[model samples]
Target: MKIYSYPSHVKQDIKEFIEKRLDSGTFGLLVQGDEDTIEDVKDLMFDQDDVTGNGSGSYTFNTLKAEECLVGNWDLLREAKEELQPNVDLIEKGPEFCDVMIRCYLLDWCFNKALAEIVNNTETVQKGDN
Candidate 1:
């Protein structure tokens, strides 16, 4: 899930794995800065909106969005794990991809200390026409 580059799995392939069940798609990748160093860091946008178990959702653009959502709706960030179950076989499952899935969810949240949406360099385009 490196920033400004394409995602690991294809968009549609992973979409079906969680479509209508979970929000999953590499809509775009972002490069946000580290508040401490002012240096650009890689980030990604795995889901269009908050990984609401349902299809539709709103972008996280408020203060303490993650914390508030965690307290108010545990499923907000939790359902991501349950949703990605099939992506990995239960037999060979570990904490790797699941961690990516979670980070993908958390990265899109704005005003969360490190949220930047500037397109500096694009390695690939994830659109219909290039």
Candidate 2:
């Protein structure tokens, strides 16, 4: 999947724009970056105190401060594909809607990757069974 990082200052605006699209029935997913990037994003989205260590090596966002706005991470997306069977599509609304289009492309890329893995595994199993 193509990774695109928006400017830190624009994250809130981006989230708001994404929210509107989501509200209008547009399906898009926002995958978080690495641990450091996650911390940076949390700083962009919430106050300092709202982000805390989860006792594990990683951190957790306090729900009391802000609602979860971003989509699931890569692992979560893969799990969702396996368990939830999400129907994904590449949406192209043209240049005027470039932002959402990019998101759609990313989601499409990720979904296709997962689908290919599933198909390959199925074929491997079938060959073993033969």
Candidate 1 Cα outliers beyond 4 Å, as residue runs: 1-77, 82-91, 110-113, 116-130
Candidate 2 on 11-129: residue-level lDDT in tens? 33334433443332222112321345433433433322112121221222333211121222334334434443345431322221222222232333333343344446657887999
Q: Which pairs clash (backbone N, Cα, C closer than 3 Å) in model 2? A: none
Tell me which residue pairs clash in candidate 1: none
Q: All models: lDDT?
A: 0.33, 0.32
Model 1 Cα lDDT, one tens digit per residue, 9-118: 22332333323432222222222233432212212134434332222223244424433433433343356556654354522432333334444544324223322222
Per-residue error for 52 in candidate 2, Å, reads: 23
Report each candidate's C-alpha RMSD, comma-separated, in the order given.
Answer: 15.5, 19.0
